[model samples]
Structures are given as C-alpha cells and as structure tokens.
Target chain A: MSRALLRSVLELRPAVPRPIASPRILPATQIRALQTQTPRQFNPTAQFVDPQPRPSQLPEQSTSSLSSSSQREPPKQKPNPPRVRLPTTPPEITPQKLDPSVKSLLPLLAAQPAHYITIHIHGRPYLVTEGDAVRLPFLMPDVQPGDVLRLNRASTLGSRDFTLKGSPWVDERLFECRAVVTGTEQEPVRVMIKKKRRCRRKKHVFSQHRYTTLTISEVKVVTEVPEDA
Target chain B: MTIRGLPQISTGRNGVGAFILQCKRLDFHYCDWAGSSRGMNGFIKSLLPKFAAAHPQIEITVSPRPRKHPVVVGHYVNGKTKSIEVKNMEPMQVLQKVKLLRDASGEKDKRTTKPVTSINESVRGIWSPYHGNGMRV
Candidate 1:
C-alpha cells in the first residue's frame, strides 16, 4: 500500500510541472504577437489597412496619406491638377526699331552701370534686377527645375541715368530677360476651425499652398542685332 | 481668409513711363569744292545749327569728306549706322531725311499680317481632341 501511495505522489508532481511550463510559454507567445502588431502599425513599408472605407475609394489612395487627405476637401481645391505641359513652340517675336532721337540716346543709357527691368508675366508686373529671387503668387504650371523662361513683355528698362519706357510693352527684342525656375516653395499648413452658429459640429479645414520660385538669371539690353537676324 | 499675398516685383515697360531716344549721334560729311555739295554746304551753315540746338540729345559733328558727295549719317543705339545722300538736295529735303532717320528703330522692316499683336495668352484655351465630347461620325 505504501508503494501505491508513492506512485500517486509522482503523478501529482507531473501535473504541477505542466501548469508551470504552460504559464511561461503562454507569456512569450503573447509578447511576440504584440511586437508584430506594433511594427505593422508603424512601418511605412507595411501594407496599408484601411481604417475607414470612404478614403479607399479615391483614385490617389495608392500613394502616401498626405495627398489622400487633401482629396477629401471640397471641390474648390481640385486635387493638385496634373501639371500642364508647356508647349515647345517658340513665341512669335518681331524686331522693332527705335525712333532716331530715341535710338541716339541708347548708347548713353546702356553705358550706365546697373539696370532694372519691369517684366510682366500673366499681366502681373515684377520689377527686378539681375540675381533677384522672386516668389511668384501662383504655382507656375508645367514648369520644372532648370527650365529657362524668356520674359519678353516688359513695361520699362531703366538705369539711374535714363529710363526707356514702352507705349504698352517694350519690344521684347530690345531687351534680353531670362528667368530660371529653381524649384517650388510650400507655405506652412494652416488649420482653420469652421464652426456654425447654434451648432455643436466643428470642422477643421487645412490648407497648404505651394508657389513657384524663380531667379532672374539675366537682364541685358540688346544693343546688337539679334543672333537670329 | 483664402487670399494670400504673393511676393512679386513690378516689371518695367521701357516706354510706358519714359521714352529714351534711340539715335545717339549724327555726322554731316561734305566736300567744300564739289558741285554736288553746294546745297548741303548751305544747309549745314544755316539749318543744321538750329536742328542741332533743337535736339540737344543728339551729338552732331560736321566733317569734310574730300572729293565725295555730301552725306548725313545717323548713328543708332542699336549699333547700326544709316547714311543718306543729300547731294544737290535742298535744306528742307535734308531735314526730312534727318527726321526719317531719327524715327527709325534700326530693325529691318517687316510686313505685319495681323492687325493687332499681343503677348497675352488667349482667353479661350486650345481645344484638345482627347478632351470634351467625341465628335460623332
């Protein structure tokens, strides 16, 4: 009877070991599951799991989330329209002669040290000297880095000694003005809380505008016949 | 609230605010003994001085071109020179030529087909075949 009692004690000891082993293994598995889930949420390369179904319907969902949120706003802000491609065709320009009296004075004007030009783009005037960096009011459509733009329409080209003014616009062939597109600049995001009277709902409107940046690469008076001539 | 100011510089329109004369100088060349320079010599002595005084901006020079016909050359700011033969012409005719040269822009004359020319983009954008409703056959 004592031998039977000893065997029963051994069996009871095995049951205790089993319960201890399970507790240790279970904690390790739970920790591993948590680690995997955390990475999935934070990893940029991980597959995107839609938290809400509405956003996934938009066309630009494949890219990063910043552009996706911009799309959800009102139609007034169209998804940054596809950049318009500038035509490769050259502008039609005709060389013009100055009145003899005006022509005679050009040498003295050109001899003056520095000059400034008032160039017009899209009917807006920008008075600048060479090497001036201008932040345009609107994003230039279809322009890219290193693209050279010839500014032909000008109101005036002047120096301290003399000013040459145009009736409406100075002949483009009279002056050689060029601008190089450096890149684009973005303004800081602005958040506006829109609240209606007698209503509890508050909508957050976010906007970030972008502008084209350009540098006045050159401004020179055309004293000689144009190369094309 | 949506409006934002864009920093831009005003562009210069050459003749919009002020006009600069393009003709910088005039040189009168005449032969003292040549019969062809008789009227030109008289004009230089009489009408030329008043014309020079009228246009202070223009630098005028009178020099003898030995044995050659009388000529007036206009120096333009465009690095071009226009010469007019005033041999045997009256002072009035020489004055007209001077006015013509002074008004010239120094560019070759071109036949303009369009009634009006502008740098502005067209208000109506170009039509694209890929866009808008497809034309029915």
Candidate 2:
C-alpha cells in the first residue's frame, strides 16, 4: 500500500464508493484487518478482493474517527481453517528393503495401475504404447526373432489426450497400458577384445544386438477423472 | 522437435500417436527434468526426430510423465517409449546402459515380484502437492 492510501485508510476516507462496489469494501476491510493481525503469515498489501473499482477507500481524516466507527460496529471474526482439495496418493509403491512391508505391497499396489510399462533405453524413455516398434540399443540376450514380449515398468503413463501423472512414481492402480512384443531385429555381431601380450591374457568381448518389437494394444485410465489433467 | 534445459511437457497430439517404445521391468534410477538439455535431453532430442523421420506414418511427441516424482519422472512419447536417460554418459555409452536393462528384463511376464502387506498407522501419511498446502498430488 502507498503511504497516501495508508493515510486515507487510517483516516476512513471513503473515495469513489460506487453503489455496486460498497458491499465488497466490508470483506476487503476484513482481509486487511486479518493481514494487520498477522503480517508475518500473510501479505498486508492490497489483494484483488474487488476488481470493479481499483481505488482506495480509506478516509483522509484522523484514525480517531475510524476507531470510533469500528467501535460502533462490533469487531468481525475471521473464518476458520480452510478445507483443502489436494490430490490423493496411491498406497506405498516403493521397496522397503529393511522393513519388508513396502516390498510386500509393491506387487499389489505399484503394478496395479499398469500392465505394460514403458522402459527407457539408451537414455530415452520409450512410449511402448500398444503396438510400438522398439529396437534395443544392443542385441537382446537369448531372445529369438518373432518372439512376443510385454514391456512393463514405467516411470510415466498417459493417453494422447488425457494423462494421469504420478509423482516420480505415478500411481500404478490408476492405469493399465499393455503391449505385445514382436520378433528380434539383430545387428551384425562385432568383437572387441583386450589383451596383455607379456602375460598371455586375452579377453574377448563379442557384441551382437538383438532388439524386440512390441505392439501396444491398450492404454486406459481406471476411474473417471474431472477436467484437470 | 527439440527439448532443452526444460522438460518438454506437452499433451500435443504429435507426442502421442501410435507405437510407443517401451522398456519393461526397469529399475528407474533418475527422474529429474527428463528433457532438460543438460544430459539426456540432447540425446533424446536427437533420437526422437530420427525415429519420426524414419516412420513418417506414425506421429510422435515426447513429454514428461504426468505427476512429477523423483523415482519415475521422464518423457512419454506416443505409443513408443516412456523415457530416454543419458545419466551423464555419451550417446553410445547411454545406448549400452539401455541395452543391458532391456536384455535383463526381456521376459514377457510383468507381474510384480513383491508380496502383500498392510498400511500401518505410523506409515499413514498424505501426499501434499504443495508442502502440505491446498493441492494433494
């Protein structure tokens, strides 16, 4: 608040009081009073309580007049604690290595939301949406071509239009996205070996990447959601 | 087309069409801003375009996971992949890490290996979105 407005408010100066705007003055005064009482918790400056007329209403006379008027009308009380409408969380989905409790519920709660999970490969998070084509960074181990696979375990889940977000760990029970694995796509095998000549020690690192393609078929939310996404 | 120091959070159609690449049974190691150009962003930014170019029929978009969490926060692109993680490694080095994870969890079975337990009273805590403020997510 400017010093001029402070002086006017302290003096109870009624400036530009429109008929449609007079009622709002009461609530704004209440808010200001609350702010004065607890400046530490709340900001005492002008809040957007009334948007019609953006003028200060404090009188320019003396605070003594404002004090007498306040006395005439009994002091108003503030509202109690406000009810919060925060998002509710799914049950614990983390592994409690020491407690063992989190581990037990992990199977039941964490996987409840999704049947197929998009896994990240090569520093990339894959959609693995139903009917997705995935090429592994390297040849997969012991997997043949035309093999059916399901990718489960994802950090995120959402539809093209709608989305249900989980904190780093999205609630698993909220959704179920599944995919069918296709056959392997293999690159030519390559060899990279290291050896120490004097000791006759040769280490052979043979590499051949085989990736499995998946067809994601389903991605759906369990319950009805309001507009918020 | 590109994601920089900020997570490219989009529900745009291009990010979610058909064919999402997925890696299942993965133990998520990082969930910070997924597309922030610092580490993984540059890599994935390069990777997604190539895939889209090759498969012109399929539309592709990469966006952050719904709710932001440390354990799972990453990108969700089309029906293809859930995330791309560099972890401060080179492109090839990054590829090697993903390949290892894919090989380990190649089996189709995705059932959770964990057992069942109850929510104890002491553990009963609500997740407040804004530090125990108004929102809960």
Candidate 3:
C-alpha cells in the first residue's frame, strides 16, 4: 500500500521548470568582459608565471649602467690551437705480376668444380670450405653477432685437380671468402680441487669461459674481376 | 682453467690467395690493303703465337676488318673493353701495349689522391664534439 502511494505521489509531481529568460541588456564591452572572466575563474592556474625577473622590470638607470658596463668590457677571444694531424696508414704495396706459367694454368684451375682453402687468422691456420663452422682458439674481440669478416690471408687455395700455393701468405684479392659471426658460446663449468701437502686445507676453484662462434658463409673463387681488382 | 674456442671462418680476398686475370680475351682486327696493317700483320705472324702460348687463360681472335686501322681490342671480365690502335707500330711495341692491356683492371683510369685505399674501418675513430672536455676561453 505504501509503494502504491509513493508511485502516485511521484506521478502527481509537476515537470521540472525550464530556465527563465531574463530581459536585462548588457553592453558589448560588459558581455565581452564576462566571457573573458569566465575562463580565468574556471582555471585560475592555467596562465604561466615566469619565476625570473624580466628585463622590463629593471630600473632605467640600472639598465643603462649594465649596458654601459657590457659595452666597456672587451669580447672574450678564444685561442684555437692548431689541430694535430696524425699520419695515416701507408697504402698497400702493389703486387708483382703473375709468372707466365702460372698465368697460363690459372684458368684450368679456376674451371674446377669445388675448391677448399687454408686460411690464417691471427697466425693460426684453418682448413675450411663453404658452410663450415669453425671454433677459434681464443675469443675474437670487437666482433658482434651477424658481423661478416673477410678472410684475406690464405696459404693454399686448391681443388681436386689443381692447387695454388702461396709462398708465406696469399694475396687477399684473389677470392671472396666470408665468415658470419654466429654468437658467443659458453663452456661447461670446470672445477679444480687444490690441497696443501701437510695441512688439511682444501680449496675448490670453478671456472667457465665464453667463445665466439662463426660460420663460413661463402667461399668463392672470384671469376669476374671487379672495378678495383 | 676454462678452455674456450671461438668460431671463425676464413675470408677470401681476390688476388690475395690467387689472382684471376682481368683480361679474358684479346681481339686483333687488321686491314689487308691498308699500309697501317703492315706492322700489325708482322705482330700477328711472329709474336702472337708466343703470346698465346704464354697466356692460355686469354682467348685470342684474329679477324680482318677491311679499310680500318689495326686495333687490338681487350675484352675484360668486368664487361668493359679497351682498344689500342697498333697502326704502323713495331711488334715489340705492340707486345708492350698488349701487356698493358693484360694488366689493366678494366676500370676507367681514375686519379686517386689518397695513398691508401681500403674497405676496413679507420683504426682511430672519428672525433666527436659530445665527447672530450671543451676548451675554455
């Protein structure tokens, strides 16, 4: 019964009153001032206020004194020392011409199907072919993954039919040999036990070392000579 | 002591391990009736056989080009050709020119100002303004 009475009361209530229209006329300047003042009241902190004192705020006499002092002082001159130029690396010595016999036989050797090369890196010899994975004795410094290193020094470049041997080191411009740095690999931990002869003192030392891994990406006898070649 | 082995592959440099001659073919063009062909005919008859025997890698062809000056055209592996006129020249002079062509790398002759030409990075890195202390006045 009370719910029915509440519903009937709510239905009997009059609709909300619309805003009443005031016929008061304000001047254009007054309306503009009101519009401008509304935003300032809405956000009081919106305008930026610089913390430092502006030049305009200084007294004219002080400003003139400051300007006069600045004019009186000579400009600071920086003495540029002459740049020290370092000597660049010397150019590679041009190689001697090929022997007549070797020149005649080169094409026959190049016509072979497959070839292998013995390359030297840091005075270590590595007999490798294309797509071979090589593990160097020591970690290669200053090299990152995906870095391509050109193997310039080779002792022998040969195939089943022919072999081209170099005296001590081969010329670097003969072949196109590339190695891609794969990543660094870590070895298993090695533990060494140390003990004193007289005393019962014992110590265990554990060690693990990392090595850079590389893959022989390409090894091709450059048949076509490039512009610089 | 931990034993670690780094993986590395051999890099091949052309002319380092072995040099492939750039001049693949030499074409000798001579005129039969022209007086300029006199020395060229002598070179073809006397010196060409020895030259061909010395450089088996290079293919040699002799063709008669009527009314034209005798020219030795060197076909390079880089798809460029260098032609030298051997008109009225001695056989030895023609051989010298042939050697020059044989040794040529097939690129246009360029004046290289720098002494060293390399693909490798500079040993001393570039100077940067952001690094090192600034000079005070």
Candidate 4:
C-alpha cells in the first residue's frame, strides 16, 4: 500500500490534455455498465481502465474501485474512453521584447561609416553593404517585380572612418534601415571545353549564376524614439 | 519677433544665472525700400521705443535679406558634443536643420555615451513624430 501510494504521488500530475480521461479508471466491464445504465448519474470512475499504469489518463482511485465494483455487476466487455474536451486550438505566445538598453545598440552600430552589414541568410552570414554587388553560393527564390528589402540586421557596422563591432548581433530596433533592391545580377557566361584522347568524344558545358544587388540608402541612428512606440 | 540664443552665462552663483549675448528677430511690414535714409530713420525711430520697452535685451539691427525671409541665429549646447546647428530659422528650415542635427547628435551619443535613445524633447519637429501622429495647437 505504501508503494502504491508512493507511485500514485509520483505519477499524479496529468500530462498534456485529455483531462477527462485522467479522472476515469474503471474496468472494461464497469465502463460498459456505466454506459448502459440510462438512469445512472454520471460518475467518471466507471470508465477507462488498464492493468498497467496509464497515469496520463486515469488516477489510481477509480482503478481500485473498478476491482471492487466488478464483482457485484457483470458488466459488458467494452472500453468506454473518458470524455475528452477537444481543444479548438492551442495557446500561442507572442515574441518577447528585448531590454531597452540592448535594443538601442543596433542603430548606433549601423551608423558607423562604410559599415559592413553581415546578414544571416539561411543560417549563413553574408557580409554586405550599400552598393555591394555579390554572387551567392546558392540561389534564393520567391522574389519578383521590384521587391525592396531593407537589410537591417547586421553583425558588424563599420567604415573607413570608424568601426563599432557587435559581439554577435546588433538590435534591429535601434536604427532605421533602407535598402533598394536592384534586380538579380549575373556572372559572365563560362565556357568549358572537354576533349577525350582516344574515343573522339567531346563534351562541353556552359554555366552562369545570378545574384540580387542591393543599395543601402541610409542608416540613420534613431534617438528620439516615438513616444507612443 | 523676440530672437533667442542669448548665450547662457555662468552666474558664478550656480543656480540662478543670466544669458550673455542679446539678439532679436523682429518681423514687420516693409512698405518700400525706395524711401530716403531720413524716411527710414523715421521708421526706425517710430518702432524702436515700443520694442525696447517690450524686449529690453535687443537693440534692433535691420537689413533686408535677398528673398526677405526673416531668420534668427544663435548658439546652444547639445549632448556631450559642442556643435552649432541653426538655432533659429524659418519654421520649416528650423525643423529640417534640427532633424539633421539630431541625427548627428545621436551618432555622437553612440560614440561617447549610453545607448539609450537620446531625447532632447525640447527641440520640436526635430523629434521623431509619434506613431499616432498627434499634436495640440
């Protein structure tokens, strides 16, 4: 009894959802008996039973009662699952805001002249700045027709004049970023000529890649944050 | 029409002090420039005493600007940096200049001071407008 009590205490907390099932712990016979009785008041203990422990569903009290009640009534051999209140949807939490002092650092870092904005695109940081023409290691997609993105996130903001480096990331909230999207730029066509020594078989492949060009318009450090903001 | 930017003077006494320099920006109708020197003298003489009584600090000095848009200039302290932004100008011009100056000052704060958003709320229009875009006349 002490061991059973210890087990019950250890396994008492119900895990994710299905709360009604956790309360009812009767044998299959008792569960069917409860379901069949039309005039009986709803007692959750008369359903959901298993010899092995299934703590997520039924607590120990009803399981004990199931053994006692089964001797008196010869119940049907069917499992009656406890009532489950199906959740319409799960709860969602909004993103939390960073502390203000931390939030203000990003803009100051960006304001450095000739700043290199190292933006992590697909888990890889690409170092870039205004008027930077670049070729990507891989192609990016789902952009068309004058799509302008302000590449605000940066790991470093620096210039020939000065460089204020961030340990890892600069806060996006601290600065105003504006970048113009110049449509995809491409590498010059490459010609590969292949020749075989004996068979007189030759193969040639040509390839070229295009990359998006961006112009950093202005990175203004904001100090007078909007009051309502 | 009272001009500001009278230099702040150390009272030597600490808490209470008086400003050093005196300047005023006064706007009044200019009927004609063709008037004789004696006629202009009459106009200055007519206007001087009332203005003197109203604003004792200023001794009016007049000259016509090319476009006749009146402006006032003076000096003031900003953040940890000693810099000059147009202290006074046409309302629109002051607003524009203050914006550029605030940007510069914010940059200075980044270099020498704490990262909190520097706010000199006294400078109107130079301040970023709130999201709701509201003000009282």
Candidate with top lDDT is: 1
Model 1, range A110-169, lDDT digits (tens) per residue?
787677888877677877777666667666643433445667778998876578898888
Q: Write the per-residue lDDT of candidate 4 for residues A51-152, one digit (tens) a residue.
A: 533433334333232222113222232375544432122233233455565446545544544444555444556555444433334433322212234454
Candidate 1: residue A106 Cα off by (Å): 1.6
How does candidate 4 score on lDDT? 0.36
RMSD of each: 39.5, 30.3, 40.5, 34.6
Docking class for candidate 2? incorrect
The top-ranked prediction according to DockQ is 2
Estimate, for each residue in A38-70, the C-alpha lDDT of model 3 and write its tens digit: 121222121123233222212222223221111
lDDT of 3 at A124: 68
Q: What is the interface RMSD of candidate 3, in Å?
A: 30.8
Q: Highest TM-score: give the candidate number.
A: 1
TM-score per candidate = 0.38, 0.25, 0.37, 0.30
Poorly placed runs, candidate 1 (over 4 Å): A1-95, A225-229, B1-137
Lowest lDDT 10-residue stretch of candidate 3 chain A:
A15-24
Instruction: Evaluate model 1 with DockQ and give the value.
Output: 0.01
B43-124: candidate 4 lDDT, tens digit per residue: 3344334433434433334554342323323222222322233222222233222222222212122111111121112211
